[model samples]
Target: MTTVLWFRRDLRLHDHPALTAALETGPVAPLFVIDPPLVHGRWASPNRTAFLLATLHELDAALRERGARLHIRLGNPTREVPQFAREAGAQRVIVTRDYTPYSRRRDAAVARALEALGIAFHTRRGLLVHEPEEIRNATGKPIAVFTPFYRVWQTLPLRPLHPSPAHIPGAPGLDPGEIPTPASLGLPRPVDALPAAGETAARARLQRFLAGPVCTYAETRDRLDLPGTSRISQDLHLGLLSPVEVVTRARTLGCDTAKFVAEVAWRDFYHHILWHHPRVLHEPFQAAFRSLPWRNAPAHFTAWATGQTGYPLVDAAMRELAATGYLHNRARMVVASFLAKDLLLDWRLGETHFMRHLVDGDVANNDGGWQWAASVGTDAQPYFRIFNPVIQSKKFDPEGAYIRRWVPELRRVPESYLHEPWTMPPSAQEAAHCVIGHDYPPPIVDHTLARQQAITTYERARRASASEPPTQADR
Candidate 1:
């Protein structure tokens, strides 16, 4: 009997449950399907596509080293996977499960098709450390809030690490298809800088982070100017490194690993939320805030998108995202807060924009983060408690190092006025060779006024919602 090892988000060979399961059955036909929706849909990103292509090439190379090769196919998985399995004469197909709404639906369709062909379809939990259903509240319902969910998540037992196969035997006379380039998928070749892809690069990064930076991650993670983050988000998103391996290795480092571990748990938390409440993708989690008024100003959004918002930290973060497809955690919060609160724009706009730019943008985490910033999701920041861009800049990028690096117009500006360039006098601005409206745009909206307006908007929405009769339209 032969089996097909279907690769999805879980790309690496190490610690792969589905691959091991397939190997146990018989010689495996390793398969990767390039679904059209992922390449041409709204969430399609050029940078991400480039990274995925490079990662696939690396994965194929690794498979060849083990006397096996990855089979590539293009088109819908619902049709392609079953067809390929029949052609390969495989009796079973083993795959890692994905939790997204689209993924779940597609998997069901593929399963039905495979069953009709007499192929046993098996899915293993590999994307996350724990499945969503495994962790719940005392009432047997999914946990809505993060802290309690995290506390429960810490108590669960992790699955033992699955060893990588030294040799993977393949079925005879099977032709391995070539991995396609980004342009073939109708995506532009990425112009922005991106990290090296594949399992080896991911392991190296994880090892380096655990060796030192993770010890001080809690305190220094908020400092945007420092190289404080693990920078392994892309690896985790691409499945270059498994969450199980990451958590297991970090556990050996002692108490310093707690904060970093919590971050990993946060990834699980968002996925858990998405698994239980897929509606959050299209609407606010908190029903009362569903009809909250948003200005949806296109001009303000343009300013924010192009890094001309005149807020140093916000501009710097936006520019960094455009140039490198990555942003610091603190910077992400600041820019997200600015868009939702200060600009009174719909959080979905910012969410969609981030998805299009960030190489590490996963549906669950990105949507959860945007909703949290907008104060519309479980355990989100209070609507009245908005981030002050200037204050955040002073606290995180105090020396203007991060700001200057990304926003070059502010390079000559004095450190004192860097965060609030508009506060600089005419003579000071002239001396610095940068004028507020000429070289750098002025602040798009006054934070103080925007904060008050946002508070009033939410308060008014709550009162109106309280008086209105319940309607089916409410989420």
Candidate 2:
């Protein structure tokens, strides 16, 4: 009997444990089900959806080279997977394990459906270098803080890299269904063109980063004006590049790979958090900040989202996200902090907005990042530790090159006034062919005032939680 390998985020043909395991069983049939709810639902992104389609096409091409083609179907995986297996005469179904709340629920349903069909349902550790529950503390519980978790992650050894299967043994009599286009699926064309798709593009990016930029990654990663990042985050998100493969290759460079490798480890850490505390996706992980009095200033949020925040760095980052479906890591922190702290808006506001745009958006990483920015998660920054947008802009984007690139109106503004353009005197503003209120939106809220307000609000919530009795779970 054949084995059906159902692919989700693991879209690549290379370094796939589930695909390899499926082959070990007998002939293998690779399948991808385009779930409508996930593809066009509230959390759906045109950018990511388009990238996924292209990646899937590339995957089908790769499979054809291996004497097979990716089997595509449209519907719920729970119903479609079982039916597909029956058609292929597959006795077992295998997939890469996913840890998000929704993924868990979906997988549970899929497993039960397959069981009823008498097909073995199995998951392999393919997404992360280490499974969420694998790394443990002194007492064997999963570590909550990233530092300790990363330290433990380092000691855990990794297996050597293996090449893609020489050829995928095809299961005959399976139809390779229609590969849907974005228009057919009702996904809009993205404002920005997506990165090159597939395992080839992913590997090329990883190879280039490991070759050069990685040497200065530690020092230049935070720089806004340079291509300091590896830019393979989307690849990791779609499993075009495997986490272990990236890490193992980075270690071989013999440079200070600790920083670069830690970024990958951070992805693992966030996944672990999701696995242990699935509730964090919808609520504050720290619990006390669950009562944070977030504002309902839709206008402020609109301004921030459209890149008219009047803060150059924040504006640049937001516009970049809108245009490219990506953002610099430092800019992400700054913008997220501005939304939650400066604007006193809910972190979920920014979090959901990001999900709507980011190509690299992963549930675990995006949630972990938002919670960290809002100071409402495990090992989050303190409420008082708010970012001063002007300081961050000047320090990271000293020359305003990034701001100029994203916000063209600020192009003529002198570098001295670029970081805080509203501060420019009328004469200087006129001289630069820009006026603060007319040419650009003024700062919606004074950072100093907003910072104080955020601190007081967080302190109030902290006090309120302290006064309340602990839950039975806490006890």
Across 1-475, the per-residue lDDT of candidate 2 in tens digits comes to: 6889899988887778888788886788989999998887768998988889899999999998998889999999889999999999889999999988889999999999999989999999889999877799999998999999998899998965657998988888888998898889988887555899888999999999999899899999999998999999999999999899899888889688889999999999999999999989889999788888888899999999999989999999999999999998999999999999999999998899999999998989999999999999988988899999999999999899999999998899999899999989999999988898899999999999999999999999999999999887557
Worst 10 residues of 1 by lDDT: 183-192
Tell me the whole-model lDDT of each prediction, alpha carbons only.
Answer: 0.92, 0.91
Once superposed on the true structure, which residue ranges of model 2 sit more than 4 Å away at CA?
Answer: none
TM-score of each: 0.98, 0.98
lDDT score of residue 226 within candidate 1: 96
Off by over 4 Å in 1: 472-475
After best superposition, candidate 1 residue 350: deviation in angstroms?
0.5
Residue 454's lDDT in candidate 2: 94
- Per-residue lDDT for 469 in model 2? 91
